[model samples]
Target: MAKKKFPLAHVYRLLEPGPVVLVTTAHAGRTNIMAMSWHMMIDFEPPIVGCVVSDRSHTFGILRKTKECVINIPTVDMVKKVVGIGSTSGRSVDKFKRFALTPGAASYVKAPLIEECYANLECTLIDTRGAARYNLFILKVHKAWVRPLGKIVRTIHHCGRGRFRVDGSMITVPSTIK
Candidate 1:
């Protein structure tokens, strides 16, 4: 039997239910935003979230120290900005200034919410073990804000690499037992 080798782009495309996430962090009065696709909801009772931030990312350092962050969910219109933020480092330049984005203070976290995003989730670090081991952080969502129009707007979904897909029509599933 022969094993086939594939690139990460190809492998990531197979991951279903992908959502583009914008991670916000603040330190020393400086706030930054970084795009991420490696995020997901973990629990409902306490509203937990999981996100992967590389050890070298500037946001990682801020998050580690502040123990708080905001997860902003953007619409398809922000795909370009999302990719741009992910490609650059916050230490070099201010992403909000460079990208002309507005920052709004979060209700529960020090990290500011991105004004252009469709939704924002304020989170506080629940554990640092995963962050130290796998560059993963588990956060407990404290509060969330959603744009009035965001409910009707489509969101960008990452398919890995530079290819991103937009959210399509929604369908409500009925319970079989009901």
Candidate 2:
């Protein structure tokens, strides 16, 4: 197959990382949920994560004030709700109430963990140096939870604009290789 150079605008679509997550934030009794796809793991032990939350987003303000959030890993079954929540601003609507998401108590953060997601990570905003320049936040995941049966909790990864890919197969690499 012949290859042609693509435009820079389409560059992000090529390196789409990990699954889309619903970030939940709370501050001064105001809680909001925003669907995000720009999160990545930065560490192994202690589990540090990096995520981008634009200044224009309402969740960003709450996150800055509270310095806490819950990273909710939704499954393929919740794709519709993920896209639906991403299309609107959480400031205008009570996303939890409007979307019928059950918010569960977290062990380390004030932000509530989303009960519907396959996995939930309680995060504390550890650094904000990149937030002003790149809309990125450095978080430390203090607590984590995953659904019991892996068979039922299949997650979705973002490919590009409005397109998502769900987990299809499983492969386990031998630890002895290391």
Candidate 3:
């Protein structure tokens, strides 16, 4: 039997509607953050998250070594910084310093959370097989913190190619009487 091959763009589009995530990692004394829209929550009991990171990315190395990361959820105002982080590499420059981002200490992991973000989820890598083979890392979320003030702001959603959309008005569904 033969397997079907698909274009990268087509594969990416399938992963659309993925929330933008800031993959933060630290090893030794250096730390870095990268923007990724290819992330999703896979489990609920232990609160697991799956994120795709290129094997060649510097963050991948740090995550591999530390086995921990912080998924920072940014607001619509952070679109510029999100795009900037995605464009640059942490190996060449300190992304936090280069982008003027503040890092706050995490409660359970060595990886620091982006202070300016709307929400932060500290996680520890529990599965590495996917990362090695498909550049996908599965993390078990240890804790989550949300900013009260930032919650009012719209969430930033990526639409590929530097394009983004802010979260719109909310709609509530009423429960049917049993």
Candidate 4:
């Protein structure tokens, strides 16, 4: 068997940690949504999450100022809308109206939950130490919402270059840690 060398620039595409999420933020009187794929779970208890939001993005400024946001997990069925949201900026356009997505009130945050997503996590900004150096923000989830088990759908994982991989069959494995 032979293995070919992969480009260093594309390495991140191969190591995407989780499903693409639509991060919603609200400040002053407006709401915005930014599609994010560079996020990962940092802890189990209290559900800490760390995500990178480029400083240049509109959501970055709002999140920094408000210290609140909703991480909405969309499914494979919304691939087109996810891609469109990622490409468009929330600076000039209203993503909710442009994409025809419903926004529901979040119990713990000013940001609205994307009703079309399978799950919505209401989070508060916990730390910003990495924001200046890496554009990273640490979040603590205060509340979460999800559809009934029977209604849940497979999530979509970004693989760079406008390509995505959908969640597939599950394989159970024995584990002592929980």
Candidate 5:
């Protein structure tokens, strides 16, 4: 096999670890949403998620004040809206209305769930040690909902430079770890 060397700059998105998600947050009577790709599950038993929200981002302040949010997993069909959400600052726009998304009241959090997404995880910010320096928020997912299975839904994964790859094909294998 022939190996080619490449710049280290583009390695971050070689394959994003998880699906792109829309984070919905509410603070002081204001609700906002933003597209987030830098997130991962840090724990399985209690469903802990770690994500980055830039300190300069509008959502950052809102999330900081509220200390809660909803992680909405959009389907591949909603890629356009996802990009649009990320393109504009929520500070100047009401994403739910601008993106034509419904705000469904969440049962566990003050943040509303994005109705169009296939899955929504109601999260509460549980840690802030790395927030000031890294803009990293550690969230505890207390409640989650997923669209019915067997619906042929796909998730979009960012591949850097405005390019994305849709999840395709399903495979199952026997495992005893569970």
Candidate 6:
């Protein structure tokens, strides 16, 4: 087998995280949604999540000031809307209305959850030490919601360069931890 060099700029495609999530935030009565794929679980007991929200994004300022957000996991069925949300800014467009997405109130956070998503996690900002340098925001999940889907929920994962991968099958493997 032979291997070739891969571009550093496209490295993110190889390490795409779990899923592309729609992050909802509200500030001063204005709400916004930003599509995020650069998130990862940091802890299990309290459910810590580390996500990168670009400093230039509209949601970044709101998420920082309000210190809370809803991480909505959209399925493959809503791929087009997800891409649309990522392409446009809330400053000019009303995402909920433009994308025809329903906003549901969260129990803990001020941010509304996207009803079209398979799952939603209400989170509060826990740390911003890395935000200045890396745009990383550490969040603590205060509450969670999951729709009762009869079959497997196929979440979308961004592979960079406008490419995406959908959740496929599930396999049971022996584990000692659980």
Q: How do the residues 25-127 of candidate 3 rate in per-residue lDDT, one tens digit apiece? A: 9988999999888888798878898888998889888888899999999888788888899999999989999889999999999999999998899999899
Per-candidate TM-scores read 0.90, 0.94, 0.88, 0.96, 0.95, 0.97
Q: Give the residue spans of candidate 4 off by over 4 A.
A: none
If ranked by TM-score, best first, what sequence of candidates would result? 6, 4, 5, 2, 1, 3
TM-score for candidate 1, residues paired by index: 0.90
Query: How well is each residue in 28-142 modelled by candidate 1, as lDDT tens digits?
Result: 8788998888877788868988888999989898888999999999888888888999999999989999888999988898899999988899999998888778999999998
Q: For residues 1-178, write the lDDT of model 4, one tens digit per residue.
A: 8999999999999897799999999988899999999999999989999999999899999999999999999998898999999988899989999999999999999999999998999999999999999999999999999887463368998898888888877777999987
Model 1 residue runs over 4 Å out of place are 1-9, 176-178
What is the model-wide C-alpha lDDT for candidate 2? 0.88
Clashing pairs in 1: none
Q: Is candidate 2 or candidate 6 better by lDDT?
A: 6
Each prediction's Cα lDDT score? 0.87, 0.88, 0.86, 0.93, 0.92, 0.93
Ranking by lDDT: 4, 6, 5, 2, 1, 3
lDDT of 1 at 71: 92
**Which candidate do you rate higher for lDDT, 1 or 2?**
2
Task: Supply candidate 3's per-residue lDDT for 53.
Answer: 90
Stretches off by above 4 angstroms in model 2 are 151-153, 175-178
Question: What is the model-wide C-alpha lDDT for candidate 4?
Answer: 0.93
Q: Pairs clashing in candidate 4?
A: none
Q: What are the per-residue Cα lDDT tens digits for candidate 6 across 55-109?
A: 9999889888999999999999999999999999999989999999999999998
